[model samples]
Target: MNGTEYRDHRLFKGTVTERGIIDYILSLDESLRLNYNAYQTIVFTVTHRKPNLFRSFIHEKQRGLSAKMDQALKTFRQSEIAIVNALSYDYSNGLVEGINNKIKIIKRTAHGYRNFSNFRNRIFIEYKLLETKTAA
Candidate 1:
């Protein structure tokens, strides 16, 4: 009924397949259809936890998702194992990196440290290593 309402509909806003248009449009040729399907499959495989299937999805059926898509596929092919690990694993080093950055900032703020002992004590207090000292 309204602009936003119309845009929210699957036909107007969702993927071509979800709109029921890409099904017929992309199905015109075997190669073209395969390319389209492979692209969609890869997109889903990367975002979802399907490491087992990602290898086949990328290397097996990915023929050509148009000219532009071929380059992207090539990149994925080169890092196939990494891509699979990313999709399948639930771990990330982001937290460790963030903590490292915080430590760097604290060290930078304390300008003149002459010895390792002073630096070590400062780091311990910064991280609240001694509960008694921190409580006071």
Candidate 2:
């Protein structure tokens, strides 16, 4: 595993391969290449958690870009504060989100149980928090 491998994974290598494909496609059109490069800069800034760099790059480099990129930048600007907070802090809601996703999957698979107790029991069973009560 090489080229920015993490935990023995070659994710960035895959990214590089995909980027080459995109670059080739984008190079077919000058406008598309420009747009792709601009978008890549934004992605790099965000990935590195550089809000200040993002602000500067958006202000300086994003002028006269495509309408779609403008809309995306507008959305990012609107959520700038939240984005900055996310980049600045190490807090995560991943555990809670994972549990919520599991519950949703369970609900979908069950197809609407009529009894709430049974639903709760299913959750407890999934989490291994309850044992089956067998009759002798």
Candidate 3:
């Protein structure tokens, strides 16, 4: 599923009365339910734009856990600054990515244009830039 769908999934956004189904799964020995609540909190943080809470959650929960989770938390910690910036800023590369995707599709369908100039012109036309007028 895409990011929005995954974010809205039942496993991530459980009812107020109880935690998600993911929290019910136990490890091999069944001695402990996996501490996947961290993931739930992360979903909450990003969805709600709570960067401070994200920092706090990482600081408080990054210890005495399964090896996999520990590594995941470490990776989160490493990118903590970037994550905060993402949450704090409204900036996004989505428009650029969309343009690039369109260009890629055009290139694939055209089966390789004869020259770079032709390909560049095709991209400009796809974006509705018909022509450039020079100042007299």
Please give the ranking of all candidate structures by lDDT, highest first, separated by commas.
Answer: 2, 3, 1
* Local accuracy by lDDT, each model: 0.70, 0.78, 0.74
**lDDT of each residue in 9-94, candidate 3, tens digit only:** 45445432223233344433332444455666888999999999999988884544677777888898999999999998999999
- Provide the clashing-pair count of each candidate structure: 0, 0, 0
RMSD list, candidates in order: 6.4, 7.1, 7.9
Measured against the true structure, the TM-scores of the candidates, in listed sequence, are: 0.53, 0.69, 0.71
How much is the lDDT of residue 51 in candidate 2?
A: 78
Question: lDDT (0-100) at residue 58 of candidate 1?
Answer: 62
lDDT of 1 at 96: 90
Q: What is the lDDT of residue 27 in candidate 3?
A: 39
Candidates 2 and 3, the one with greater TM-score: 3
Candidate 2 local distance difference test against the native:
0.78
Tens-digit per-residue lDDT, 17-132, candidate 1:
34355555666787788777777777777777788787776676444467667777788889988887888788989999987987788679978688977777777776788443
Error of 2 at 23 (Å): 6.6
Q: TM-score winner among the candidates?
A: 3
Clashes of 1: 0
In model 1, where do residues sit more than 4 Å from their true spots? 1-40, 66-68, 107-117, 131-136
